[model samples]
Target: MKVKSLFVLTAMIGAIAFHQTALAKERETGRSTGPVVYVIAQDKFYDSIVLADLPAKGRFQQLFPGEGPSGLATEYGPGDVGYLGGRWWVDGNENGEMDEEDAYFLCPLLGPGRDDI
Candidate 1:
């Protein structure tokens, strides 16, 4: 009975040590940090975008809204911060595209409307 208990304790300690080592390696290899942004649009065709690094201590919240539309082609002007990804929140089917009369809230992910993030 004593031997079995000793073996089980040893195994448990080994497992914990292995887990810590793996986590340390992941941090040291620079495999962790990434940018974070949030965007929200309402049903009234108004959309807002926010972009920046993850909030940290001593950091202040910032809001950057785009200027109102200027031409006949563009209707929605940029508003508030920037977004990291464009999420077209529509009230229709899941076609991943915009439709007529469908309320949309698009958060541009990578600065403005770009093809790649």
Candidate 2:
């Protein structure tokens, strides 16, 4: 029984060491283990533009530069918030209006020099 227990413990330790070595080799080979996310945006002419292409695990800010209300941070509740008018929605089904298939979209709050159309 003692010899059996020792063999099992040795096997477990070897398995763990092998897994760690494999992970280190993968990292040294420059292999990414996370998904890549592409952030798309629309220009004034309604043209689709690739704003950012980064890893999904990377930190990202929702609001773009020069956006949001004055004297306030980029974070804000969506929809009509006092002076800031208009609402944001993701047309998931490619429809013009929000529906069951659509979702609430978090975008930069419009401020001075910004237009919501």
Candidate 3:
């Protein structure tokens, strides 16, 4: 009975240690374990807008009233801070559409003074 209990305890400890190691490795590799939220902007300027103000799909005119049929924004602007080096998509064609012409841009992980971190 004593040996069985010891073996079980040892197994539990080993499992916990392995989990911790995996988590640390994930962090080091910059792999997100949770949902990542992004803000799709209409332009490179990243104009300030309220989340609640965003209109549903097929309603692009609601967000930019008086504008022609500009379709929708295809640029993925920066979201909340702490994601400096994250990857984002840009509308290479400058058109409000996501097609084969779009490209990806990596957020620079620069330090203060515009130095590389």
* Local distance difference test, each candidate: 0.28, 0.27, 0.28
Tens-place lDDT per residue, model 2, 1-117, is: 334333433443344344422111233335322111111231111101122222223223332222222211223322323312212332334555434443332223222221221
State the lDDT of candidate 3 residue by residue for 73-97, as single tens digits. Answer: 2233344342333333333345776
Residue 82's C-alpha lDDT in candidate 2? 30
Best by TM-score: 3
Write the residue-wise lDDT of candidate 1 on 1-117 in tens digits: 334333433443344344422111233324322221222231112222323222122312222222112100122224544322343322223354433322333334332332111
Candidate 2 clash figure, as a count: 0
Task: Give the C-alpha miss distance for residue 38 in model 1, angstroms.
Answer: 32
Clashing pairs in 2: none
Residues forming the 10-long window of minimal summed lDDT in candidate 3:
108-117
Clash numbers, per candidate: 10, 0, 0
Ranking by lDDT: 3, 1, 2
lDDT of 1: 0.28
lDDT, residue 57, candidate 1: 26
Candidate 2 — which residues are off by over 4 angstroms? Answer: 1-86, 106-110, 114-117
Off by over 4 Å in 1: 21-117
